[model samples]
Target: MNTKFGCCLIIGSFVPQTEGKDMETDKVKQLQAGLQLLEENGYDFAELTVQFLTQLSEEEFQQAKKIIQQSSLNIPVCNSFIPPQLKVVGPTVSIIELDDYLDLAMRRVREIGGEQIIFGSGGARTIPVGFSKKQGYEQIKQFLCRCESYAVKYGITIAIEPLNKLESNIINTVEEAISLAEEVNLPHIKVLADSYHMDLENESFTILKRAIKDEWLSHVHISDRERRFPGEVEGKEAMNFSKLFLILQEANYRGLISSECNAASLVDENALSLQFVKRTWSTVEGGIANVKPD
Candidate 1:
């Protein structure tokens, strides 16, 4: 297999057991360990979640940045922002105030030597239950445009992810995200596709393939039907990913596919999941290696 076509990224969610114990000390160590594992196993990059940095103080963020800069790993850090609230609201930060948070977050990313930052289109909490789809879409479009303005300053591209209907009623499909991105009309704003959400919506891979507009697809997230490791679960569910990869290859998409699944409960089990993902990528690329380059 051509190793260049096998580039994939592993996210913190994939290795749930190994992170956030001390929050301050263990966070950086766990990220470094994950990056090492990715390099040793042949992956090209490791996606990082910024919520890990939210665990540290401003000064601690600087210290963590220094450590990341000093590492020998070639992994590129892709940043992700968790919604303001977890399960329920304690003290919520409004979307209107998100720019301030984004400013701080982007500064931290630059200080930490990261290039890309991923953001979610407003969550379920942003809209009331009785809100109309038309109204919800309008609000999301406004927020995305505002975010794009800030994103352009950092020379950072924001991959706006659309969560599943179960997670958020607004922006539940790729079409919706693409439409919003078009409305924003900014070079720095784009869409991200997550296989987990695609499964939840029962959306066809063909439909997703046709919907993707060039340059709009900035990133991808992959996982199996149950949000488990790739290749662990067999049958039609696992086979669907092959089709997804084929579409990506046909389009000549060249971006990171971050494995964002909760693969296992232990660090060792998660390591196995990472290995499984690499093997699957090899198989997928082998089948399409003959395609002519564009």
Candidate 2:
């Protein structure tokens, strides 16, 4: 499959935030500790959040950058592209604010050696009550265009993530995400397929075939229902992940498949999820389009 596996660090669980010099110290300490854990556990890269990267102070950013530069694990993909405060849709849409944030965010992403950022900011992109859905789509398209400008400058790709309707009011399907990405029609704008959301929406794995065909699928995020780490669900509760991996393998997906989930026990779950993903993917064989649940 030529796939590289990684895990997302839920920073809040691992790193405690503080104030003044202590904040910088905490951030650096957190980065060091997190990266060490990933590397020790055999992760190819680390998936971080743009929120975490952009919120850093100059000193903090520098310290964190040095830590990243020295770490064996690469930070190639980042999620949580926009925070709730930075609204990307609705009547309150602000190009100026969006531009300003992207300006700094893309630079930080590039500085930290990030190749792509997942656009899955549900809070920021949700259509407000009374706001026309049509208008919201236009707003999102405009936002992506703005993102494309910054992305091109920094050699970054923007992966438009389709959230489950529970998490977002718009772009809830892979087809919709790909459509929006196509509408944007920019080189740096693409799509991301998230297995957690797909399962939540009961979206078929066949959608990935179309995404792969169009080269719109740039990254992947995976987790079981209830946002548990992979392999946590078993028996009747288990998701047919083999089908998804087999589809991806047949399509020759060479991008990263990151575990994006909430775990009660981050340390142990991270290792467990990574092992699960590798072991599951190892069982995927070519020429088998249909995978039956075991």
Candidate 3:
């Protein structure tokens, strides 16, 4: 495994999509155990859902923070920035409440030592029917600009994630996200490249190379085609991560690569996925992936 690259262990139980169904007792234990598993298997950091983490009351936040600190793994990145009900762009939206919500989320993230937040909330950012795409684009730019303000206060960066078209109608590619980042033009705003979305969008790594060279790539999420742990993909069909890893290394990208996949066996799959990712990330060591700028 390349020491420069970092992996973010994203356990299923900690994710927001599953937050409501499970019992409180089971949830806490699973979260702690998953963190322990990641640390025991060589992962340095993990990603948490900002929305869910911020939903905790003050006391819960303190207790949760204690468990995380005790686990010895850092949380440098956060996912699920906005909740589904927040209409971020339409006329029926409540901008003030949304801003407050985002600020609260960032505050919680700052408290937990999170350095980056993923803006991949497909439902929140979606353009409503009958609205012009151009209008939606402008609104997104303004939204990100406001997000940058809050992010700056917490010493955090908002990583613009390009969701695939199926999940989002606007900003569906890294190229578009880069354009938005440039438009926002704030140091606290950046971009991310998720391999799963890239595959779904048919985005070639050639485009990602540009993000790396320009230093716009802030974080990454790696999952197999079926959204499973990389090596856990059965049969001969598997995504070729070697080129992507090489591109990231060649660009000298020192960002977090969180596993945002479905893990049937959290402990076992986390280790297996890490090992597979490490091997793939190692294929181009000392080559272009390891080049240093003069």
Q: TM-score: which candidate is best? A: 2
Candidate 1 Cα outliers beyond 4 Å, as residue runs: 1-22, 74-79, 86-96, 121-126, 211-213, 236-239, 289-294
What is the C-alpha lDDT profile of model 1 across 1-294, one tens digit per residue?
A: 332312233333212344444655666676666656656655555566756655567776666676666655443445446444421112333664566666776666656666667665344234556655576566566555765776677767777777787767667777767877888788888888888888888776655565454578877887777677566677765746677877876676777777665524324445566677666666777778766779
Of candidate 2, the 10-residue stretch with the lowest lDDT total is 10-19
Which stretches of candidate 2 lie above 4 Å from their native place? 12-19, 286-294
**TM-score of model 1 relative to the true fold?**
0.80
Tens digits of per-residue lDDT for model 3 on 138-211?
A: 88888888888898899999999999989899998999999988888889899999899999999987887888
lDDT for model 3 comes to: 0.79
By how many angstroms RMSD does model 2 differ from the true structure?
3.4
lDDT of each: 0.62, 0.86, 0.79
Most lDDT-accurate candidate: 2
Each prediction's RMSD to truth: 4.7, 3.4, 3.2
Colliding residue pairs in candidate 3: none
Which should have the higher TM-score, number 1 or number 3?
3
